[model samples]
Target: MSTIERKTVVLTGASGGIGMATAKALTERGFEVIAVVRDPSRVRDVGAVFQADLANLADVVRVGRELAEKVPRIDVLINNAGLHAFSQRTTVDGLPVMVAVNHVAPFLLTHALLPKLRASRGRIVHVASDAHRRVTTLSLPDDLVRTAQFSARESSFLYAQSKLLGVLFTKALARRLNGTGVVANSCCPGLNVTGLGRESRTFAALAKVLAAVGAFSPASGARIVVRLAADPESGSTSGTHFSRDGSVKVDTTLVANVALQEQLWAETARLPAVSSLGDFR
Candidate 1:
């Protein structure tokens, strides 16, 4: 008897939340799971772990390049790490913390490892959210660089806007990757039982109560992500929004607006943080 080789999956935020559960599921499915985490000590039972604090753009870039260099055959790249701050916070780069971690870091990492992904024809899955609808309007170019202090109550709308940007990025990236054999898609993992500690103590306690009632378990939340990332049936799928269900794509003006998506892509590429990385596909 011989041990079978597993596909490579580079997952961010694997130390906790849906990412941790997704890491477990992907491992069980016979994929070699490589975790890109902020704290390496916190990660366990994965094939390997790479450290990168997504809130810091420089660290993300460095780690992204490292992963691209080290992980020779990446079959799936899941930009699954994200954060929700009730009170406004900014990264060292002066960008909003949520925007920096959720959107910008993933964008940079994807670009950094794109060559490997293209070579392997891998799948890219982003954990997005339905809260995008909470934001009725999106100000492009400006939103990409917008920085402001937001209250806890107002953070939801800002968080919604950030996920909306992910949807837009998926649309644009799928277009760029049309002939490259790399597929890109985003999904809302639903409200989950894990990752509550990062938000606040109140939410953490709420999560415990929710879990006691058997609601939003991590495995169930990670199912669609696992399917989108490794399922052969999903290989050709791109630019689709997997909302509560992948069979029914989520409909959002932001997701469908190609012109807006294109604009967002261009502006993101031109951002000082991203542009400093040089021209990226």
Candidate 2:
């Protein structure tokens, strides 16, 4: 089974619960796996690790370029890396850390590798969350660059907003690749206890307690992402959103709004990180 030739999957957050699970599952299914993580030492047994801090746009952009140059072909790019900061912190680029890691970094990385992906007619799976349902509205220009401070209690709403941005990005990207073979979609992993906000010893204890309770395991969350990345049938479906179950269709309140989606695309494109790569319409 050495060097079995299936497509390759570029998975972010591969060291985390769902990422590790997805990397193993994809490997077993014969896809070559390349993991992009913040700390390479933290991940092993996952094929080829490329380290980059998603919270740092410069680091993310540089890694995106390196991956495109190094990986001959990319069949699927899963933007699974994300965090829930109990308290607000901002990146050097001035975007909220969560937004930087979860949404902006992926947006930039996906575009950077668009050529290889386009050549391979690949699929892009965004690891979004159902928490997007909590936000009733989103303002693109303001939200993308907001530097205001918020308490831990206010962080969940911000996290939800970022995921909703992912949904918008998926739909908009799918539209952009309308005739191209490349496809894009997003999914909610459902109450994943694997990643509860970072830097909290309290949440760490809660995670172990939840682990003992046998709820929302990371392996379980990785299933839909695996299906979306590996299933030939799923390759044909783009711009569709999936629920935690992977069977039910999630509501597309903001996701289905073409106008909003395009606006997000335009605004995201306007960001310095994205614009530095290339002009994306």
TM-score for every candidate vs. truth?
Answer: 0.95, 0.94
Provide the lDDT at 231 for model 2: 87
Instruction: Name the regions of candidate 1 deviating beyond 4 angstroms.
Output: 1-5
Model 2 worst lDDT run, 10 consecutive residues: 247-256
Candidate number with greatest lDDT: 2
Error of 1 at 256 (Å): 0.8
Quantify all predictions' global Cα lDDT against the true fold: 0.84, 0.86
Q: What shift in Å separates residue 125 of candidate 2 from its native position after superposition?
A: 0.4
Checking candidate 1 for backbone clashes, the offending pairs are: none
- Candidate 2 lDDT over 1-281, as tens digits, reads 45645688899999978999899999989888999998898887766889899988878888999999999889899999988887778888878887788788888898888999999999999999888888888987889988788877788899899888998888888988889999998988887678655457777878888889997789999999999999888988988888878865646577668899889889888887667656765
